[model samples]
Target chain A: MRNLFNYIAKYHFFFLFVFLQVISIMLVIQNHHYHRSLFINSSNFLAGNLYDMRNNVVQYFALKSINEQLAQENQALMEKFPESFMKTDQQIFEFRDTLHQKQFRYINAKIINNSVRNRNNYLTINKGSMHGVQPDMGVITTEGVIGIVQNVSRNFSTVMSFLHSETQISAKIKKNNHLGTITWQGYDYQKATMLYIPPHLELARGDTIITSGFSHIFPEGIPIGTIDEFEVKRGDYFFTIEVDLFIDFNQIEYVNIVKNVFRDELTELEQSQ
Target chain B: MEFTALKYFGRFIVIIFIQIMILNHIYFGGYITPYIYPLFILMMPFSIKGWVLLVVAFFSGLTMDMFSNTPGMHSSATVLIAFLRPAVINFISTKKEFETSTEPSFSVMGKTGVFFYVLILIFVHHFSMFLLETFRLDEIGAVFMRSLFSTIASVVVIMLAFLFSGRTKKVRI
Candidate 1:
């Protein structure tokens, strides 16, 4: 017993180092998965507040660009206003047209902290559970799709950005509707790779890629990116196509949280099958 | 003793602020992010106990992870570098002895000594961090590239920091 104690005392530092490394590695593995909830992320109270404070100061510098984006979006929205359309039909139609039911709702949120340099990037938004934000909700901008909400606090949430290595979105080429999965290669912030695209299909440069509505998270036809370059290796069945993403992650300051009203029903029905 | 502890605490806060707030935002070339946070562990007093050093490194890394949303990647890398710091110092400091409680700096270890010290430690920290972040063998090349670029960037920043501080020390003298 004395020998064992002496041995432990002698090599205690090594043991402590190993112990800390094990704990850290375990944390890394645990947080790597999409479903696991972590308490120490930036969305936590203290970090969230700190980021919020920083954003308050830094947001001023970005006001001009934000205004420009908002003006552009406003112009687009103005074109969709009811007054912009002239009613040419002589037949009066009933106001209650039940053809389209609401499938998604948008909640506006300001991003307080965002990182694109990391292999697994996450963005912290100011809106959280109190604002009806929840895990797995899709986040998007007026320009393009952003990410999925992973963790939520009272007034803050962390979004797994599309730039993340593990993030895969169901997307399709707009022209032919050929479906593929979009994934980041951890190299470029402005680009992603589209996989599962067979080499036999005709592809062109600048072909638009949009979200396929197959996943309950995002609505169909949201702009993802455009095809940049593609090549098929000999004997390989899939085309290695690079996409130029529409969203410039560095300049993103505001995002909209997408709440799918029928998500629970859709998921339950799929699971039952 | 209390004053020294307070000074170290202040430095901890300042270094972390610079790391997450300032340096984290500077994403040079979209791939390289210079991490000078490990300089805190590198600058620890020579006589710091092993267990204390390890504990300090773990917390320092954990703090960075909290802000960056990487829970364990920084901690694991920092702990490994902290564990190897003593051996690295001994390997480099042949025929010379550092006074107890003296922190490693440009004035204390000279320019080349500090440069090599920062280079090796920062490279190890960044390589381990990138490896753990990716957690795959297939992309080892990307991990190595990232580590190499980031280490070079971090070494330059840390050396500049040392030079500026050394100048201030001269002024104090």
Candidate 2:
């Protein structure tokens, strides 16, 4: 016991190092496994507002590009107006008042901070719980799918970006409705991999992959990306296809958090069963 | 002594500010992430206790992790470097002691010593960080590539930071 005491006393620094390292590793594993490290994440007010201040300065240089994207989106929205299309096809469809219920509501937020390098990258947005952002809500941009909200604080939220390796979204081929999973390979930001697709089905370059609403995290029919390249793996039953994502993560400045009103009801029903 | 402590405290805040505010956002093709926070840990006064140093390193890293949304990657890496710092200094320094109240930086450590020291620690930190990130042996290639590229970038940035860290005059506490 005396020898043990002396040993510990002598190498206490080493012990401390090991102890701290172990705790840190535990934190990392815990975060990876459960993603419950909420306060430690970037969604906290301190980190969030720091990003806000930085974005305030950086947004100026990006104003021109942001204006261009806004204009493009404005034009797209403008084209959807009732006046833009001819009335010839409108007469065939009968419309009833009070028949439509709002399914998805968008809450706009600026991407104050974003990263694509980490294996588990996160994006910090300026909106959060107070602003109607919450976990599992789908985030999107004018171009395409951005990511899903991982966590939220009172004033800010963090998104699990599509670039992350563990980020797997339920997607399907827009043409044939063949289901697949869209995931990042921890290599490219613009490109992601769509796996679990049957080889028998004909797939072509430029085939569009969109959210299938199978997971209910995202609304159906939101465009994700297009097929860039694909190959049949040896001794595998699926095609290894590469997809080019529509949203350029590096250039993204603003996004919309989707609030699906029926998500709670769907989850409650599913869980009760 | 109080004056020196205040100066170190100032450095701590400044370094953390720069890291969280500016450096964390600078993403260069997902290959290089320049981590300059380790410099603050490296330049600590030699008189600090081992446990205290470890705690400080952990806290510093935790703050960075909070900002970057990396739960423990930064803290773990910083602790590893901090744990080995004294040993590295003892082995490499030509002088037995680092002089009273002298900051362990480029001007004080000399160019060659700083370069050699930063190179090893930065690589070790980056490699360990990447290893912990992947948590698998299959990505050794990726681990080495990222660590190497990131270490080079971090070394350059840290050296420049040290050289221009307002070493003009001593400010009283």
Candidate 1 chain A lowest-lDDT run of ten: A90-99
Give the alpha carbon lDDT tens digit for every residue of B1-116 in model 2. Answer: 69877887898999999887778767666567788998888777666788888988999989888987878888999899889888887777867676655667765678888788
Candidate 2 residue lDDT tens string, A1-273: 999999999999999999999989988988787456857998887888878888899899999998998899889989988778788844535463434776778899889998877777889999888987878898987677888898889999999888776788899999999999988888778889999999999999999999998777787888988999999989888999999998888899988888888899988999999
Q: List the residue pairs that clash in candidate 2.
A: none
Over 4 Å off, model 2: A1-7, A89-99, B28-30, B94-97, B106-108, B165-173
lDDT of 1 by residue, A1-273 (tens): 999999989999999999999999998998888776468788899999999998999999999999998899899999887777787877445685535887889999999998888888889999999999999999998668899999999999999998887888999999999999998998678999999999889999999999998998998899988999999868888998999998999999889999999999999999999
Q: How much is B146 displaced in model 1, in angstroms?
A: 1.7
Give chain A TM for each model in order: 0.94, 0.93
Write down the lDDT that model 1 would get. 0.91
